[model samples]
Each structure stands twice: as C-alpha cells, then as structure tokens.
Target: MTTDLGMPTVASDPHGHLRGTEPFPVAAHRALADTQLRQNLGHATRTIRAKRAAVVGEVDDWEELRRAGECVKADVMARLPELLEQLEASVTARGGVVHWARDAEEANRIVVGLVRETGSDEVVKVKSMATQETGLNEALGAAGIAALETDLAELIVQLSDDKPSHFLVPAIHRNRSEIRDIFLREMPDVDPDLTDEPRRLAMAARAHLRRKFLSARVGISGVNFAVADTGTISVVESEGNGRMCLTLPDTLITVMGVEKVVPTWSDLEVFLQLLPRSSTGERMNPYTSSWSGVTPGDGPQTFHLVLLDNGRSNVLASPDGRQALHCIRCSACLNVCPVYERTGGHAYGSIYPGPIGAVLSPQLTGIDGPDDVNASLPYASSLCGACFDACPVRIDIPHLLVQQRAAAVEAHGRPTAQDLAMRAAAAAMASPGRFSLTERVVKLGRLLSRSGRIRSVPGPGAAAWFGARDMPEPPAETFREWWGRRERS
Candidate 1:
C-alpha cells in the first residue's frame, strides 16, 4: 500500500444510510452525554482489547503474518477486476449464478427481486455489513418481505430498533441487564422468568428464532471472502447461526462487496488466520462455514451471489485510500480506538464505525456539498495511530485520515479559518524580519490570557478559535532574543 493516504473524497457516492444526518462533532457531543453508553462501551472495548492482545501475543511470527496479509490484500486490489471476473466465472461454473450491482440501490433491488421470485415473504438473514450498507432489510420490508436477523447481537439491535454500535458485537452499547429488558419487551414467547444471564439471554433468542429458522425457505447472508479459484464463499462466525442459514434454506442469496474476492484459496488462508485473532481474539472461529455454489443433497438447492460495487470502484480508483477495501471487517481498530470508546459507533453515523468508518464512510459517500455531514468524519480521530497498529492488513489509517481530511477540505471549496491562518503563518515565516514581526504580534495574544492561558478573544474568528480550545501564554523571552544574547556571551 502507498504510504501517502490522501485521496479526494468525491466518488460515485453511496445510495443508502452510509451517510449520517449530522456532523461528527454534534453527534459525538450527544453520545458523550450518555453515561450508560460510555460505561457499556468502555467495558466492552477494554475486554475485547485485552483478549485480542492475549491471543495476538501467542504467535511468534504475528508481524510476519500481518505483513503477509497486507501483501495478499494489496495483490487482491491490484488484480481486483481480473479476480472478480474469475470469481464470477468460477461461481457460474459451479451451479451458482452471479449478478453484478453498481450501487446499494441496485443490489437491494436484485436481492428483493430474488426473494420475490422465491415467492417467500419471510427470509432468514445473518448479519451482513454489505446489506447493512445497502439498507437491505428496509428495502426488503418495503417489498412486503420480512428479513429476520439471526445473529444474536444483530437480533438484539433489530428487536430494539437500534443501530449496531460495535461490528463484532453489534449490541456492545447495551449491557446484559438492558438486553434482558429488551428480550422481555420484544420477544413474543420470551420467558417471564428470564434473568440477566448470558446463557439465558442467548437461549431466549435461540428459542425465539428456532421456529423462524426451521420455516425459512430463503436465507440471506454477507460474504467474508469469495475464493476466485474454487468459487468458495466463506463466513467465519462465533455462533452456528450462519451455518444454519446457509445450509437449511432452500434458496441461499449471498450479497458481497466486489472487494471481498480473493485471487486464491491460499490468499484466503492468510486472512482466515488473521481475522479471528484480530477480530475476536480467537485462534479459529467456532463456525467457519464455506459453500461453493450449491450441492444437490448437501446444502441449499439453489445459490445466487450478488457482487456489489456501490462506489467501491471509486474507492479502488483512489491511489492510497483504497487500502480500506483491504479491511477484513475485523473491527480491531474500533476496539483500540480511544475516540470510539468514549462516543461509541452511533457517533460515527455509519454501518462501519470507529477509525475505519471515519475514513471509509466519508470516502464512500464523499462530501456531497460544503455541508455534507460525512465531511466531519475524517476529524473523528485523535490521530493516535492505534488503529494503524491494530489493523491486520496494516492500513496506514492516520495517513488515510489526513488524506480524507485534505480531500474533504478541498471538497468544501474555500479554505477554512485554520487553513487561512496556516497560510498566513507560512507567509510570515518566509523571512527572518517577517518571522520576528510575527513573533511580536503573537505576543499580543498574552493580553487576552487569564491565568496564563487565552480562553477567549475579542474578534469573531479568534472567538471561534478559542471557543473550545485554550492557548498557553506566550513566553516572556522570544527564542531569537535568547539566542542573540547567548551569541554575545
């Protein structure tokens, strides 16, 4: 991957709920006020971080594996077109029909049409970020189809009519006690005696979905990886829900991003090892399901693969930002993000959240206009570089953040106040005489200082700048003056 991460955020633009309604700062302020949410997020992220560190530490050549994964993903991106075409041919040859979609609207249309052809109004769905990005469930519902989420965490979020806060554990923002309340209120046949126990909550959800699982004829899922060589589709999950949906349904429809295609099974192997460790802190997932099209008496009777672009081509067209497509949906960055731990995923305003989301979401929808809320996403980070260090594919996220920030500012047209100020400073520092004059002018800021810090200023521009931030008082002696005296001595 290129070390330079900045690429223009403007692209084909996304068609679903990928863009948030409000800016990051506004949403973050609201999220920060929710003490319970902060508590839940802090507890969940810390636990996951500890687990990931423990498992990641066990491997002697973990960095090598990370490098290998990075290389594989880079290769995939370089040959993505060829790999996807090969994948289409491979899947088509293996009794699977592949349909291509340019955007979320078309993908949802294809999926909804397929379900309509099945003549089944109800379909069982495993958690699919691709579908989430497309707003697939809502689309299906509008078409008179009921898409039921089978993943326990996804189910909880669905039941509560809430958005997922964490990628691995969608309901991470909610505690066990809150979950018990949701189960009691939402699940029709939930036991009144259910306690705030993990086993009990899982059993409650399982019992509720058991009937739906058995009766569902069409199962919808998101793909983790599509092997172009063998036409194999693999999904790694902690629970058996994905397997149940993949195997039991009469018609299986898989919605996958075009970037999910891997050139070979061996390439897939590297990610299989990297994903579990980076995402769930497990050496291997409990239910790692794979299906190559359809089998007569084995799995689903018919299979369809929907390959979706949805602005991914625009992302790929980018020189450095395309490393986002390399993401394995591990959510390792989210677990390590200090910002996400405080504000949670809801603040990011995308299906993808945290550090990756901050960069990826803005790139997908881009800055529609000066006021586009997605523009605020690039500034969501502390630039701590924790995310880059945590990433399995080694995406340079801090650099990517800078790239998106520049792109966003460019998209916004005229320079911002900070930009103008930086330019002014650059001009002033061009010569020694100007630099000394600038230093004298900066000392004037000390007049506004209270307790040796400038908390407020008179002018509108200065007021806005100091509204949320304070600047330390200027030193009594300028560095140039001190150096001049030292020379004389």
Candidate 2:
C-alpha cells in the first residue's frame, strides 16, 4: 500500500526563502482564513494539552524535574564547543566518524556526499528536526537518492508533499479523513475503499512501510540526546519505527544539533524520565532506542555522525538567544500555543514552529535580508505565558518572543507602520491641548453617525477593529474634559 516516492536526487541549491517584513501575524491571517485547518488544530491541541497536564501532574516533583532538565541543557549550551569536542572524541574512539557542519547548506552537502559515497540510492529517516531544517529529502532527491521517512506522522507528511506543522506530531493538522485521503491517493497498493478510521489508517501505513523498513540500507536520524562519555545516541519514540531506523540499516548516519550532547549516560537517565512525560504525555515512550558506534556483525557496520552547528553558535552568542538551544524537542510549547492552534506549524515557515519557533527560527537563520522567514516569526504569539509553563526546559518563550520582536523592529530602522500609528495615538493622548483638539474632531463625526456605533472607518487604523467587531461611538463629552472640570474645583 506504499507508493515509491522516488524524488529526483539532482544537485541544486535549495530555494532561498522568500523575504518580507511581514511576520507571523500576516502569515497567520492567511492560515486563519482556512476554517478547516483551524478546527483540526484546535481539537488536536486541546486533547494533547489535557493529556499532558494529567500526566505531568501525576509526578509530584514535575517542577523540580523540569528545572533539572533546564539546568542540564544550560550546562551543555554554556560549554557547547568543549562538550561537542568531547562528544566527537568519544564517538571517534568508539569508531564513529563525525562531520561538522556550520550551517544548513553545509550540513546537507555533508549528508548528500555521504550517501553518494555509500553508493546507495535510498536512505531511511527517523523523524528529525535537523534533517527537516536542512531539507535533506529535497537534497537527496536532487542527488537521485530518495530519503524515505519511516515515522508514521512524517511518512504521512512526505507522501502528501506537505511540510510538518508540529514539532512532535508532524501531521497533526490532518484529521482522520484527510489522512485516509492521503493514504489512498499516495499509497501504491492501498485499498480504494479504505475506511477513515484511525486504526485502519495506521494499519495501512504500517503495511505500506514494512517493506521499506526491511529493504533500506542506509539510515538517517537526529538524536534526542547524545551521551558524551559513552558515545551513545538515544531516540525516544512512541512507535517502534525508530528502533527499525536505528538497527536495520547497514550504514547509519545521524544528524545531531550540537546542543544535544549530555555529559554522561547518567544525564541520559534524568532526561529519559523527563522527556517522555513532557513530550507525549506518556510515563514512558513505547520505544527508546540507544546505540553506540559500530558493532561486529550487529546493526550498522559503518556509522557516521554529523554534529551540526547550523547557526547554533550564532544563537549561543547572545545571552537570550542561547536559551533556545536548550529545547528538548518535547513539543510541549507547540501544544500550548494559541498561535500554533490557529495557524498550525506551516505558517512559521521553518522546521521549528510554535512559541519556540518564534524566537529560535529568526536567530538560527541570522535574521537576514530577503531570505529569513524567521524575522517575522516573533509576532506569532499573543504573548501568553502558556508555552513557558509547558516547556520541559522552561525556556521563557514569551519573554524571548518580545526580545526577538524588538530585534525585528530595530532591523527595519526607525519606526514601522504599527509604531508610527502608536506614536500618533500617544501624542494625541499625552497633551491635554491635543486631546481637546481630537475631541472637537470626533464631535463632528458623531453628528454624521446614524446610530451610537461606528460600523466602519476608513484607512489602516479601522482595518483591525472593524474587521470582526463593532466600534462604539465617541462619548458626547470626553473623559479628559470631565476630569479637567473636576480638577479645576
């Protein structure tokens, strides 16, 4: 029931992301217009949120555990370069080859060249944000090698030619009916009359990917954590697909962000306890795959580990931005984000999405000229503190989002349109003389009003408030005028 998605692997530079000053608000406006997507996102997020809260509450020491997780990641980020070198040495000592990539382009090139050298036309992939950020599938497709996603949600997204909209749940935007449609249309041998039931869909995907699992010779993955002392890569997943991806292939290529390193196997123990509950709301993930380098006649005979920077060092340079690298990929922030609930993940226009994406994406990509989708990402949230509360690492996402917004505003030079409007309003309000002048202007408007409500007003200011709700009419006497007379007494 699986389609052979043989994307052409021809070498080409990935498309430069479109440039604009428009941030997530503009992007979300487009997404919010899609009623179907909003409904799907709201339902999914609410369900996951409740589940996570229940599980998290069951642990009496959840806050303490979360703080420990935060400190562990902070410790790694604080000493990133040295820890990375330690990780490289440990992996190298265990016969693992390590490649360092400075950015997405370099990372993709390294992986593409590695696949080409293996002389294999295909590679199986575990669900990985690093691979997504690099557009590895497109890169491999360019080189004439197809990268097959083995994770159920990722497989669904890939088959549909769609990007993932969530951190953990890649295809969370798609409901059962949509999933059935995707499976039916894209899966080569899927039954035409397959029911849109959840179990049915999973079974169909399972049947389709089974052969790919057995046949894939090269595996690509990103790690949840890398133990520096023991040189082990750990992946926690709900399904067993990661186990297959980790063990089945002959040559395993892992792409890990530099921040994923933990000092020892004992550190893995703490995260192993924290991650599953925080991420999937499970006491334990159904599967947690751990593997070292090569073992004679077991698993992959050749192992290549790509320790990716991909602009992480630049993020680490700023005190505020460095906190972003502490993320555990739990997706807790996504589940609690109101903006993510409305627009879903695609609107963020990066591999990272939701509250974390708002801050992380802009910084990771260096908030550049025309190519940065991340520049506008900061305004994606409503400044609600839900994401910070939900974070396993407690990243203070709302505070960071504000900082990134300031950065974006500064990048645009003097005042933006929104800024100018706010400034004008403040000037009118601040001066008693100006307030009286505005009151006289509004009195003239009240005479023309048929009712005590203003249904619409011309120009940019009215555009926002008039779009959804009615605007109340100006009072006969302004509040300031009343206050002025009382003060005179």
Candidate 3:
C-alpha cells in the first residue's frame, strides 16, 4: 500500500471551506439576471434533453437497465471496504501501484507528487471530475507545473480560467465566438485569423494539444469505473483525447473515488449501457479505454491508482443518504433538472453541481458541519423529482434533499420564526373557530391591496414571498362563511 504524499492543507474553518462559501441561489440570481447565460443554458439543456430522450427511447429495456445499474452500485457500497482491498490486491498483482487518499487535499498532493516524481513540468490530462474537484490544475500551477486539459470543452474552460457551468459540457456557458476568442488569445502559435466554426475550433485545439501529448511524460485521469475482479480502470469519452492521454504517456496516474469501484468486470457492463445513453445520448462512446496495470511496451509502463475517500465514507454512513454515491457521473440528472437548467453548474459552488450536487455536496461535506454555503445547498433544488427519474442510478434526489434539509435544520437549530409560524398555522387550521378567525383577519388584509393585488407586504414571511412573486388578494368571505350561509338558506 502506497501512502498518500503531498496532500494539500485546506482551511480548517467549517463556515469558510472552499466548496461551501458560495450559495447557489445567490450565484443563480446573478446567472438568471444574465439574459445571455439564460439563453445559452436553455439552448444547451434543451438540445441535450431532446437527444437523450430520443436515444433512450430506442432501448426497449432502458428502465430495466437503469435498475440493474443502480443495483450494482448498491452492491459495491455494501461490500466497499473488502472490495477495495480486493481491488488493491488485484491491481498490485497486475503490476500497478495503489495509493489511498482521505480528502481532496490528499488526492491532489498524491497526484502532484506522482507527476513531480516523473521529472516532468507538464502533464496531459483526460477530462476527469476528480481532478477538477481537487483543483488539480490550480495546485499544479502553484507548483509551476502546467496541466493541459485534452478534452475540447475542458480545454476551453481551462483556457478561459472559468469554472465549468455544466457537468458534461464545461464550456456550455460560452458560444462559438467566445471559444474562438479564447483560442486566439491563449494559444501562442495559433493562426491569427480563426473562424467561429466548430470544426475549426476542434482542429485548433487538436494542434495545440498534439505537442503536449507527444512530449508530456506523465498523464493524469479519473476513472468512470474501477473493476475489482480484473483490476481494470475504465474511461469513456466522445473525443479520442482520453484515449490519447491514456495511451501516449510513459507514466499514468488515475485518481478515482472509492465508490467508483465495482466488484467484478460483469458489473461494468450495466454502466456501459446506462452512461453513454444518459450522458451523450449516444448508443456508445467513440472511445472506451480500459487498462489493467502495466502492459509491457504498450501504453504506460508505470501506473498509479489513487483511491480517494474525500468524505465519501461519511456519505456512505447514512442509510438514507448513501445512494448519493451511486451516481455514475453520466450527468443525466443535470440535463433534466429545472434548477440546473436555469442556474447552471457554478451556482452550487462545488465541482459537483446540479441535482446530484444539491444532495451529494452537502452530504459529502455535511450541511451544518462545513461551509455556510454548503449548508444552503439542500435548498438549491425546487423539490422536483425530475432528477430522480433522470438519474440512471436512481438516486432519489428529492428524498436526499429533504434529508439534508432536516440535517441542516438540526445543525443550525430551527429558525424561531418559521417554527413559531408552523405552530400557529397548525393551531388555526386544526379547528373551525380558529380557521374562521384567520379568514376574517385575511379579509381585513383587503385594506392593504391596491389595483386588486397585494404588490408588496410588510412582515418577514410576507416580504420573502412578495420579494420574488406577487400575492393575489384574499377573498372577501371564507369558504366556511359561504358554506354557513348556503346551509341556512
């Protein structure tokens, strides 16, 4: 077993942790106000949603396959610790080294130190969420090592120094013209005159990355799944860039969460069907690469697998919450999420965003245990179960959101106003006398209305409601009063 070396030290403060500092609603408020962002998000999500629906419709057994996938993941979690040791043993037997990481800082340190040991100042990267979650590029930058993103969208995000706005399409926030500008500005030797065309943009990125691919001695990646039976790691991508990064480099380091492991190769077949159809709306990815340890003179001879904990164990500890770890990162949940569609990914303030992020981030980091913003994540969703239906893994996000909200309320103590209001509401509605009195009070509220609408209101709850929406005027008579009059007649 290899010890995790060079782990980064994160701030110890709970309220001020990196992922929890930004509130989704606050960030989403700004994103919503940007008409351009709204247009971009609407267009992108609608297109992907349609495509996914079309492809998923082609499968007669899609629902069955989804259930199967979820089952395999649950099974993996059930036997996680034992399976991890089994995976470690299998990988070692196959000439691969395994390292364990407890958190993001440790994962980053292990990856950076591995690259440093390769004696390379540069490393080629496959589009990996784990690295992004750990801010690997930023860590490498601080160490004076350049980590080049080989995926086209990821390359665009890296070049722009912008956070990803979506899971599958990181550059979804930017249009073609914006991409052309980034390439022209960042790529030193690119042709000065570039057209805002998709083909041209792809070719330019290809040219820019080609040199790095050939010269870089080390490569870093995240796995879609790690099969324990054969000790194999898998990467699925539309672009062949992932394959290039996996194959071309002499030293390869893959950072994967412990939950990514499955018990056997057969279990991987279930995800192979679920991920592609859910994510890209394709029957199969163009490139599906699988490697088991070192292959003499074929691909990288030196292989290192970093198994990351990074709060997953905490997520797994909760019986109701553990399903959050079942996510395949296919991002199907994001495409269909109303909240994700409008707010985009950055609003969540974590690498993991969208419906999955709403539940996963809070649980992995804890609602009240860490960042104030993290605590606010449970409120990010509108409690719609669209995410649950869209999730190929069947993570009941609405259920998880409620659980996290309960957890958050417990941690911070119930809001006195809300608690008191609920108590008052229960008392009023529980009896006809109290209900009549409440209706009469609301009838008096007619005095506050102008133009047949209560455009604005004064109390905290009233102001909170009217701040975003207008409340219609209350009726002159309660239904009970009308019912009483009819009965007397």
Give each model's whole-structure lDDT: 0.89, 0.82, 0.84
The parts of candidate 1 lying over 4 Å away from their true place are 1-13, 426-452, 458-460, 476-489
Model 2, 417-486: lDDT tens digits are 5677788889999998998897888876675455787776667766664654575677787787789889
Least accurate 10 contiguous residues by lDDT in model 2? 1-10
- Superposed by TM-score, candidate 1 places the C-alpha of residue 428 at a distance from the truth, in angstroms, of 4.9
Model 3's number of clashes is 1
Give residue 337's lDDT in candidate 1 (0 to 100).
91
RMSD in order of candidates: 4.0, 5.9, 3.4
Error of 1 at 412 (Å): 3.0
Instruction: List where candidate 3 sits over 4 angstroms from the true fold.
Output: 1-18, 369-371, 414-416, 430-434, 447-455, 459-461
- Against the true structure, whose TM-score is highest? 3
Highest-scoring model, lDDT = 1
Tens digits of lDDT, candidate 1, 1-489: 122122223334356868888988889989999999999999999999999999999999999999999998899888787888798889998899998887788888889999999999999999899999999999999999999999999999999999988779999999999999999999998899999999999999899888998999999999999999999999989989888998998999999988888888888889988999999999999999998987889989899999887777778878798899898899999999999999999998888899999988887767765578888899999999999999999999999999998888888667778778999989998989999998988888888778998898888888767865798999877999899999999
| Selected candidate, larger lDDT, 1 vs 3 | 1
Please estimate how well model 1 matches the true structure, expressed as its whole-model Cα lDDT.
0.89
